[model samples]
Target: MCRLFAITSKDPLSPMVAIEALDVMREGHDGSGVGLFLRDLGGPFDDMKDAPILSGIFTEKGIRRLDGFMMEIGFMTKYKLSIKIPKTPPPGVPKRDIYLIRAYEYPEEWEDLTSDEKYSRLMNMRLELRKMGEEKKDMIVFSFWPDVIMIKEIGDPLSVARHLGLDRKDLMARVVMAQGRQNTNYAINLYACHPFFLEGFSTMTNGENTAFIPIKEYLISRDFHGYTGYQSDSEIFTHILHYTLTKLGLDIQTYKHIITPLQDKSIEAHPNGNFLKHLKHSCRRLIIDGPNCVIGSLPDHSLFMVQDRKKLRPGVVGGRPGMFAFSSEVCGLDAVIPDRDKSKDFQPMHLDTAIVGPDRQEVSICRQTEPLPLLR
Candidate 1:
């Protein structure tokens, strides 16, 4: 069972909506309500021989191509409301912290592509990073932003566990020890991609007609047998998440959005059958600056194969300005900046600084004279 979990305040304005939406995508389901209507792609679709071309590709063909792209790949079942909050949150609570779970179903034959293609993409993505470093001297472009780069010194691993009433894990205990070695800060960025509604598949046709299996029972089925590599890296982390959530008495549901084949007249019910098109405009662009690591982990996991700045480029920069950056000098002499204005008449002195920028916008920055200790 593919799943994503998160905690958020009950406040409607809480970033939880957006975070849950992104998680639903990562779990690979259109989910219920608006999501359910969008993920279904089972009905017959209208041909696009005469449909006016929009964007770089024809709308109809674009949808068909997308369906072809992920035909048999098993993604997560629709989003599940594992835990529900009270209608009226507790007083003094600014917002409700919610935990979400999203599941994925991938075909066995296509598993290699998920892993291999991802590795290739990561290796090639270095070219784009190199170009950015050479051209955009003011910023950093990292694969794992909010997770590894824009980490929250206070509310992340250590703090979160404390809040959750769980004993401090050894991994986090070490991070705290490392934090004592230097200053740490946090920043947030939200990726605007739909996982449930893939361009490679049609959800309109599949709307409401889809089938989803419960993640718990699925975990014990044949599909879970003979799986490898999940033990390494964050895979087990997700498994642990499943156990944690289940122990908390969360509820799970299954639903599929099946697109009707184009041959049937019923397919016309879903006129466009281009779920991604709905997503194109519906996709909201967001930049958060708090404990939003749950969502950030999505890109980190998806593009896990991407190399780091030191490896991708000798002097490459990445992440938010202060969250992560590159320097010309080995120690990044430029990062250490003196109060240039403080000097009455002497030459300018550069300070040690790392600039983090997102979508052409500079957000937070990290600067310090002391060196950051290396973590094993």
Candidate 2:
């Protein structure tokens, strides 16, 4: 029952997105979920008297919302911990505001420890953490991403390892290797603009077989190649905007200018001659602020830095902006085709956000992948 968590200042100095993500975590897992304990600390809301700040902020009732969602997704709740605290003094160093308290729930066979045994181990682990000088700190507990997948088949790691044809030690090694590959892949997605992992393959050979299967090659292709137009639907653009704004601390109002030109060009190039005519004139200009809306073409290759760690740099090598797998120049078998009928095509996917690494690399943020796949 080992868990991982993150703790950071709730101030703008610390990414607001990270704090928002805490809300998501609070609303995404159940009390028994393995990773719930990792979300044990939070705070420094804009309003000191925020509801979450006062009442059952991280209460079992509140966390249940997230837990229910997880169960809906075929994962069961196994462990969790949530704590809410008041804002600390600015000068007084805020101890670890975020504490990722993980409980390693080994299989029942690991030694059916009563509450006392569990408490003892917890105290021991805490002592060890203290020895390592991690009292109230945000630390990356372990490099290994626990394989909850094992729970799907067996009760414990030992059985899972044996089932996978590896000893416990070997299994741990494999897990680390796999996690490393996943971490690198994530870095690549962040570097590339395609941050969201939404692309899938649709097979319509038979009308009955119109289903989607996650396509890895498509992701690789997009990473190597990139997006086409200034399509708002693409998640890549959002990530680019997020990373850019976060790192540069530029005003969003000014961002509209940067994007205006691209929008204008996209409108000009639309297949339909009339911009608003195709809609049967039903669409109204809800609020048109001419010229103020577009962002011109951003070069395919560009340089940028992380928000908190500006010195940490990365380069966006290439990517398509608005289009999907439909308009790819690289068709199957290296054959160049003019166009493919979309009546039988799978929808192009977009990643939610791309996380650029310290090096100039990028990777998509799909549910973390198995590290083993990237070893090749």
Scored by TM-score, the top model is 1
For model 2, the stretches where C-alpha displacement exceeds 4 angstroms are 1-77, 80-93, 101-266, 272-314, 318-376
**Candidate 2 residues 67-112, lDDT tens each?**
3532443333233323233344122222223222222334344356
After TM-score superposition, what is the CA distance of residue 341 in candidate 2 from its true location, in Å? 33
lDDT of 1: 0.21
lDDT of 1 by residue, 1-376 (tens): 1112211111111222222322333323222111110111011111211111111111233334323432433322322223333545333221223322222233455356655354334323323432343353322221211111111112222222233222212111000001100111112111111111111111011111011122223333424221111211222223322322233222110000111012223223443435323322221111111111111112111100011112211122222222221221222212222222222211101211222222212322221222212110
Number of backbone clashes in candidate 2 = 50
Question: Candidate 1, after superposition: displacement of residue 358 in Å?
Answer: 18
**Residue 171 in candidate 1 has what lDDT?**
13
For candidate 2, give the lDDT of residue 299.
17
How close is every model to the real structure, measured as TM-score?
0.19, 0.18
